[model samples]
Target: MPRILIAILLSCALSWPGIAQAWGPLGHRLVARLAEPRLTPQARAEIDRLLAIEQASSLADIANWADDLRANDPDLGRRSARWHFINIGEHDCAYDVAHACPNGDCVVEAIRIQADILADRTRPDAERLQALKFVVHFVGDVHQPLHAGYARDRGGNTVQVNLHGKGTNLHSLWDSRLLASARLGEDAYEARLRLDPDPLPAGTDPYTPGAPAVWAEQSCRIALAPGVYPPRSRIDDDYLLQHRPTVERQVQLAGARLAELLNIVLATEVSR
Candidate 1:
């Protein structure tokens, strides 16, 4: 795509009200926070080295940095707006690189690209640090089902619905409403999540080479589940009861996978 057209398309996409409603800061932070304690020692050390460059404390501190770029740094944000999600729904949740991740702008590819940059020790700390932030944020995004949903509704941003009589879109429904309905603060929510019997994948490779695409496929399937879209415009308690577990599980997995990805990425960094 030409630079001007890319800019115009992204401008319209970003201009959509609540297009960002997916995985609010709390959701992003929750993923990063969950991964902190799970990181391998080596990964933690490397992460610390990078975080120091920014005077940051933990991955959670930079979790939402990507999402905030449009407001905090307009130029880069405009260039990166499309990096957060993909339209795999058109392909039945199966990723077709040409169709789903064209031009390598979507979240799945973004994760890989950023991870590569992060894993290259030859790269400057500033470059790797930004890549680390992108990987963290994009991982959280891909796990949000709609981020990989069909393109019909722009990953549900255009699918209007109601919760408690308030108007919102499906993207926001999952992004904030369903997660927020629990009525617990993020720390409290973390406590509840840690209690899950299956908090992390068992007997599976955390550092799977097919990560971001695989994650996106799983999420797209969830978004395509029967009745995921409410039968009517008004959403009800049953909607929350049905999908909240899915939301929570995705968050947990994102964190788990992030820790694993970091452990491997940093461990395999090019020799200093």
Candidate 2:
């Protein structure tokens, strides 16, 4: 990883984490790192080509650009705030485009639109590169569960809790704390995830290329599951143990699917 990205990731982890969006920088980069080895030759080449425009070298290089928009480009950040997640927990963890995503503004729709832009060879590489960035980031976002969580609590951002003596919300805990609890650096953490001997939970297999809507619904269901809120709203090791596995699995799933998505969009010959 580059020093710049490492600085950004650490900065994100240290700051008021998850104050902006799902999965934070670590999760997004992990997803991209996991996707690297799975890319097809064409996809890799094209990705490299697109990234070269900004002097980037890997998917991880661009993974958190979407989240950094708040500081780097406020107008774009405001325009894309909703692209990080969707509210569907109250709607039975279902995919109702009209209700869950009005005016095609949510993460699900964002992924679809960005993918279209990326797949269009007619589009400028600069534009395609931005699309690639969004697709990488939003795909990871949709898998964070809370990103597709209930609207009532603003995806659990309002559901306060005490984590290791610090005050935060469930979303922030899941986004940064649980992962930070591992106390490993990015390289070591990725190694831990990569070397895990246990099989991934059944549905998280990345080979399954489901639509963004399906992905969001799956995440919403997880967010609404029991124990996620916990008794007395306290976040301790038990909560982390119970939920960190889900976070890891989602990261793995996001990485694999992100690779597949790029493979298709950057295939040797794409149709429009």
* Candidate 2 structure quality by residue, lDDT tens digits, 59-155: 9999999999988997888788888888989889988888888898899999999998998888888899999999999999999988898888778
Clashing pairs in 2: none
lDDT of 1 by residue, 135-184 (tens): 99989998999888978788888789988889998998888778898898
Go through the candidates in order and give the clash count of each: 1, 0
> Candidate 1, after superposition: displacement of residue 163 in Å?
1.0
Give each model a TM-score. 0.91, 0.88
> Which ranges in model 1 have alpha carbons more than 4 Å from their true place?
1-18, 201-203, 268-272
Candidate 1 versus the native: TM-score? 0.91
Best prediction by TM-score: 1
Clash count in backbone of candidate 1: 1
